[model samples]
Target: MKKVNFRNKDMAWDISALILYPPGFNEASQYPTIVSVHPFGSCKEQTSSATYGKALAEAGFVVIAYDASFQGESGGEPRYIEDPSQRVEDISRVIDYAVTLPYVDADRIAGIGICGGGGYIFSAALTEKRLKAVVGITPVNLGRLFREGFSQYNPVAALEAMAAQRTIEARGGEMQVNELLPATPQVATENGLTERDVFEATDYYKTPRGQQPGGATRMLFSHAQKTLSWDAFAYAETLMTQPVMAVVGQKIGAFGGYRDGHEIYGRSIASKDRQLVELEEWSHYDLYDKAQPVSAAMEQIVPFFNKHLS
Candidate 1:
């Protein structure tokens, strides 16, 4: 593993990333590469990116896991804001940096993203043709989540509240933020977040298990406005012509269904090769770090990229 930094020209931020090289990697030879995007409000060191980076590197692919511009070690103002547009552009910027590396095979570059990062990767892949293949692990469509609520149960009130918050922020009120996870496991359970997936996510992201210094659970209120307008699957049918795969857990507790992943795959009508892999008995957060599910996900991921990028 090696740390690197690059300037995001479009966003004017310095992006920090870690590149993992396959064993016996030689700079003299070009190798297939994969860009692993981190989840929303997470950093390079978080579970998903790091896990996939190491696992994929061991499988003979150069994997680059990066911090989003405003979130982790990257440079950006009003920190911790989750802007979907900027997140999508970050993948392209990383690809820009990747193509310059001596050991990177430009033609074989692909992308993999977990959770919210998966949504951004799909959005990026819509127009970023350089990404020959894309993989999404238990992907969440942030736009849908923001506009329709996590459970898709009661979004009308949530949308109204978000709009009101946007108005307040636009009028010079202090920036409001919301916690992405419960403050404590006790609180999570008190709020009926006892489902295995939700409980595990709280444990992993909020507690010592997977917590990093910059990996906060709070995000700007304005994120709702941006996310509400952004659709991850916009123009996917025609624009997403690249081979794509969305690996979702069969029992995704947080979202309650695999509708988002299925929508992404189904909308990619122009993709000659597309797949939706559902892991039995796994939940949304299970794919984040649970050894068995992570390994199982990679089993599908490695071969998909290998076949497509070959």
Candidate 2:
């Protein structure tokens, strides 16, 4: 495990990155690489995607995980804004950086996106021909979530209000964006979501288990509205030509959201390589850490990448 920094696209934006490489890495040898994408508004540390990165690294691949632009240690002003297009571009930029490394096998690079990141990875994979195999873990399609609501999860009006606020921000940058998670005991029910949805989200942002001083949060109103318009699944039919693997937790309600979407992608596309794996007794957040099924998922991830990327 080594801490590293790489230059990103926007001026003054530098991405803080971590590289987990197998023992005996040397200029003489090139290894396969996996770039782990973190969830929306999350840094590399909070999501525990690093756990997957590290495990894959130890298993003989170079695992690179970094804070998304404008979040965590990554540089960007007016932080916590969510631009789906920019986030997807961040994945591409990270790949741009990864390919320059001498120890990395440029053709063998793969991606593992968790939570909202899962959707972003898919979005990028749709257009990024360089990415070989892609994995989506408990993906949250913000467009669908904001438009249709989840499992009778109603925040339609509240989300609309948020969108209106975003429009206001875009016209004139006056209002500071609201931090979605409240300080102390972090409330997730602000959007009229059920207690379970709120509590589950709070478990990650509030607890010492997943908390970071400046981790994931609500996007600025302008960015929020833009994300509402962006739909990654829309490109599923075109993107499914590449291998896509989706891992979900069967125990959680929101888990079904992406499962059905991925299935639709598989059905619509002509590719035979895409697959879906549901981990028994695991919930959405369980994949965020070193829980039982998460470790199992990690084990499966290496082989999947190996089979596809090699």
Candidate 3:
């Protein structure tokens, strides 16, 4: 694995990334490349990102796991801002860097994103023709996640409150920041979230199990406006023509499920080659780290990239 830094021309931020090579990799020969995108408010070092990078690399592809601009080790001001548009642009920016490497096969570039990053990968693949193939693992379209609640429960009032906050921020009010997970297990238990998705997320992200110095738990509250309005599959009917695969867990909790993956596959009208794989008894967070579920997801992912990228 090698660390790399490059300029994100679109956002004017320096992106940090790690490139993992296949075992006994030979720089003299060109190899298919895959970009692994991290989850929301997460960094390149997170379990999903590292897992994809290592697994794909061992499968004989040059894999890159990158920190999105403005988060993790990347260079940007007002840190932890979650701009969907910029996140999509970050994938293309990383591709731009990948093409410059002599050992990389520019024509065979592909991408895989986890959680919210999965949504960004789909959004980027829509217009970024350079990405030959794309895979989404337990994807979440933040727009839908914010506008329609996780279980499609009532969330209109919450969205309206976000709009109101947007107005406040526009008036120079201090930017409100919010935590995506409880800072402590006790807090999660106190909030009656003992076995919920957020509870698991809190344990994974805030504890030693998946913690990383660069993996922040907070994000700018104003980002809710952009997330509520953005649709990850806005152009799937026509613009998203690339071969795609979406892998989702069958037993994902109340906060998320196979809805986004199903929606993405169903709406990919222009894609002649698209598939959805649901791992049995796997929760959304399980796909992030658990060995069995992650491996199950990779079984679909590796072949999808190999078939398309070849």
Candidate 4:
């Protein structure tokens, strides 16, 4: 794998990415390519690269795993903003860069997004016609995640708070940041989140299991409004027309991934083809990096891309 950079011209920022080539790569030969997107508040190196980047490259496809705008090694102001609209646009920008390469077979392109990345890829497929196939891995719909929460909440309250924070920031006050999950396992227990998936998330994002410099588990408080209101699976039956597959784990507790994955698959009746693969033993975070769960996911994932992008 080698480093590459491209512009998100719409957002006026740059995306930092790792492009992995199949063995004995040659510029003269065109190959099917995939854009691997990382989860919310995560970087390319954590799951996208650490798990799937090299695997897909070895499977004989050119793969580009990228850091989202305003996070990881990518460039943007007021960093750590996990905006769904921008994130969805980022995939297309990467596709723009991918097609320009001499070795890429633009017509055979597909995408797989992890967690929030999964939602973004789904949203991208709703309109991005160039994508022949798309997959959602442990998909989290930010709108559903925020609005519904563990039980439910008055989203107006959260939106009001976000507006207040933006006002403060406009006055040159300190920017507020919020953690995506309990900071640690102990913290999770103290907060009464003793689920297997929640604990696994704390382990992966907060500890050495998945921690990295740019993969911060924080997002801007001011930007929460957009995420709270945007539904990742909105208009699935009408808008999404690409071949789709949702690689989901058994939902353990109130986790958003399982719910969103099934939601998208069930709703996308208009897709060219739609499939959902559920690994009963795995939880949401288990699919993030665990060997057994990851392998199971790839079994469904690899062939879908292979068939559609062939």
Best candidate, lDDT? 4
Residue range 13-118, candidate 1, lDDT tens digits: 7999999999999999999999999887788998645689899999999999999877888988888888899899889899999999999999999999988989
Cα deviation at 247, candidate 1, in Å, is 0.6
lDDT (C-alpha) at residue 150 in model 4? 26
In candidate 3, which residue ranges exceed 4 Å CA deviation? 8-11, 150-173
Write one digit per residue (lDDT tens) for candidate 2, span 86-118. 788888888999989898899898888888888
Better of 1 and 2 by lDDT: 1
The runs of at least 3 residues in candidate 1 whose Cα sits more than 4 Å from the true structure, single-residue gaps closed, are: 150-173
lDDT of 2 at 257: 39
Clashing residue pairs in all predictions, respectively, total 0, 2, 0, 0
Candidate 4 clashing pairs, residues 3+ apart or interchain: none
Q: Write the per-residue lDDT of candidate 4 for residues 61-168, one digit (tens) a residue.
A: 999999998999999988888888889888889999999999999999998888888999999999898899999998888777778772257788878888999999
lDDT of 3 at 156: 64
1 against 4, candidate with superior lDDT: 4
Worst ten in a row by lDDT for model 1? 147-156
TM-score of each: 0.92, 0.86, 0.92, 0.95
Candidate 3 residue-wise lDDT, 20-83, digit = tens = 9999899999999998999987899996457778889999999999998788999887787888
Show the colliding residue pairs in model 3. none
Kindly indicate the candidate among 3 and 4 with the higher lDDT.
4
